[model samples]
Target: MRIRATVATVTAAALSAALAVTALAAPAAGAEQDDTPTQIKNIEVNQNRDYTVVVEAARKVKFPISALVHDPSGIKSVSFSLQHGATEAEVDGRIAQVGPSRCVKVDESWSKCEAVMIADPYTNVRSNALAGAWGINIVAVDGEGNVTREDYMPLARIKRKTHLSLADATPEPVKKGKNLTVKARMIVASWEKHKDVPLIGHQVLLQFRQGASGPFKTLKKVRTDRNGWATATVQATVDGQYRYDFAGTSLTQARSGLADFVDVK
Candidate 1:
């Protein structure tokens, strides 16, 4: 039951550009599979102070990770510490033990690891609470070098604070006989101010479903092309729980950040 994920070759330069203006990095030399996963940044919280650090997995390998330090049945223990710029990083997460087959036990690929520590050597499992926003360089080491070599989470991309005026989305409750309508907008800053954020030009698809608990339905999908706006309409159903999902990009549809929950009538 080891989960294997396809590694896509995304240029680090592309991600660097998404960050604040900086000199572009030459793509690491290698075929897609040979290259390591990009170092994702946790810099949005504090540009110069406390921040979260995320170490990415190899494109070819899938491993379950604990945000903190606890042994999940199927993943191995992975840990690291960082010190960069003005900040010092102390992480405390346990890696899920991977069986010999090395499949991905965890369903999702990206997560804010839960293991926390006021210091790095011990257990401090609060996956989301971060102490300081200081930026720094990180080095991650794992036992299975065959599957995952060491990786880094960059310090430059941290956002000291979130934009209060950024736009968000919500979906109408789906009915047994009716459809659903998905909506999007920029509530924080003007359409122009959000240019740096990737959600703006994204061609989005709205997805929803409800049932006893099984394969969910793909209710609807659409594109966001008009002035920093997108919308979708779908027939709603009489399911007890309703969830609105985004189409393509991973970061767009968050129940907290980009998605919505609605109760059916």
Candidate 2:
């Protein structure tokens, strides 16, 4: 059984700001019914040099989405959308539609279609309630009125932009063998607050490197506290730089903080 999705149109201004909206010609009126089902294949989505869709603050963002549509009766139109909640009723109003345009007929039975997926923090994702995996929805139609849809397919994860900071690394010019404490904080962009806040109970790595050229070696691993602070102490041995690293999780992006140089006298 094929489930139909209710796709809402994004604002004209938002579409104009995102990309040039072109209207793909639909099949002519009174087209004959061929009983052929449209099939969507080879779908791809990309943004921020990654498969994951990264949403930012301020204005709307656009990314390219491409797919191949096949139907023996001839292709009509193809479009894409986003779904974030468990049920269609929950996410129906939040649907971010990718304007159907830029489709080229490969042959009589196949067409290559490309569209831009728009992410507007202000409109589409107004709050954290719409966070997490925003599934990709593809809808294809054939000239014979036969329809095919891939609903809420988890192609790539949708994540808000995140950042990590090495707030402080103490004992700047400590004597050899003395203990030096390193402090850091991890924060993620909040859609509701519109600011970055500390992310708690996450693992962080304490790393050190000699001078400014070589790779940083992990000294110890520590987890962040309720206050979103990760602290670890290490004995001063040689002159080098210390830093904090977060491998991140499925919900966040991996980040490395700035290294703090400490002179061991």
Q: Model 2 segments beyond 4 Å from truth?
A: 1-33, 47-50, 57-59, 87-93, 106-108, 143-145
Candidate 1 stretches greater than 4 Å from native:
1-176, 186-198, 211-217, 240-243, 246-265
TM-score of 2: 0.76
Residue 69 Cα positional deviation in candidate 2, in Å, after optimal superposition: 2.1
Q: Compose the digit string of candidate 1's lDDT tens values, residues 1-265.
A: 1111222222243233323221121223451322333222332221222233221111111222223211122123333333222311233332222232122223333333322222221222122222223222222211221122122333322111112122232344445567556666421111223222323554443444454455445545445454545566655556433333333221122221234555666
Model 2 agreement with the true structure over 207-228: per-residue lDDT tens digits = 9999876999999999989877
lDDT, candidate 1, residue 27?
25
What TM-score would every model get versus the actual structure? Answer: 0.29, 0.76
Q: Look at candidate 1 and tell me the lDDT of residue 176.
A: 56
Give the winner by TM-score: 2
Least accurate stretch of 10 residues (summed lDDT) in model 1?
54-63
lDDT of each: 0.31, 0.69
